[model samples]
Target: MRVLSIIVLLLTTGLTSCWPTSVSFNDTGSLHACLKHFQMDPLENSAPNAPINYPIELTEAIKSGIQNNTRLLLSGENTKPQVTITGKITNYVVSPIALQEGDNAAQNRLTVSATMDIYFDCPNDNYTHEMKVVSTRFADYNSSQDISSIESQLLSEINTQIVQDVINQILSNW
Candidate 1:
């Protein structure tokens, strides 16, 4: 019995040793190590059909998402940042989807697109890079519902998707 107990103890110790000592929960992947400061410029709304408030809402959402997912800090107005993101709403359109009997629409799809230009400055590595990413996402609502009644919810979903896309673009550089 003593031998068995010793074997079990050794096995437990061996297993524990193989386990990772530290786990990182950061979603920024390798970016947390290099880029520490970020700045977001006010987005321009070039989409003629988009609501006036869309640029503000999307800017805030992207900022919040980055802060929550990465270790990067927002640069102060007076400070130079290691990263800068600027973008414009390029497209916003609503169209019929899933046509039914007599060509009536069963659902309507709201699509939003944005063009982002991200600049990275890593003084430590003497590296500077710029990338342009265009992210487009959509949400659907029942044709019976008026778009005005559901626009906010649809925009919220699209914004989340756009945020993820932007993050992915940033992380993929490394």
Candidate 2:
């Protein structure tokens, strides 16, 4: 019994020693620590077929996402912000994606595309940097369902994806 106990203790110690002491699930650190304030401009809708309310919804989602994910505060035009974001919805389309027998539509996809420009104001350094990002995301639904009934849900999913993409781009600093 003493021999078995010694073996078990040795094995457990060896296994634990090989494991890391700490782990980080999120590698994307905070956006530049110097940036304390951010300004977001109203996004423009250039897509002819998109709903009138879509631009507003997406803008609000992006704004809230940034505020919730980062430590930066939202600033108005009266105050100069360290960062400014401007974008436009370039495309919105719904089309049949999967076809079944008899040329019937099995599924339809809703695609939304947008373009964004981020301006980093470095007043202390007397220089400014701009980054442009174009992101496209989609969601699919059964063809049997009416698009009007599920449009809001689909947009919500796509909004989350786009928001994540924007956040990743900002943090990547590339």
The per-model lDDT (C-alpha) reads 0.91, 0.89
In model 1, pairs of residues that clash are none
lDDT of candidate 1 over 1-174, digit per residue (tens)? 999999999999999999998888655465746688899998999999999999999999999988887777899978779999999999999999999999999999999999999999988888788999899999999999999998999999999999999888887874
TM-score of structure candidate 2: 0.82
Off by over 4 Å in 2: 1-30
lDDT of model 2 at residue 133? 81
Over 4 Å off in model 1, which ranges?
Answer: 1-10, 22-28, 32-34
Worst 10 residues of 2 by lDDT: 26-35
Global local distance difference test of model 1: 0.91
lDDT of 2 by residue, 26-78 (tens): 43474665677888888999999899999999999998998888766798768
Question: Residue 1 lDDT in model 2?
Answer: 100
Worst 10 residues of 1 by lDDT: 25-34
Q: For residue 115, give model 1's deviation from the true position in Å.
A: 1.2
Question: Pick by TM-score: which candidate is best?
Answer: 1
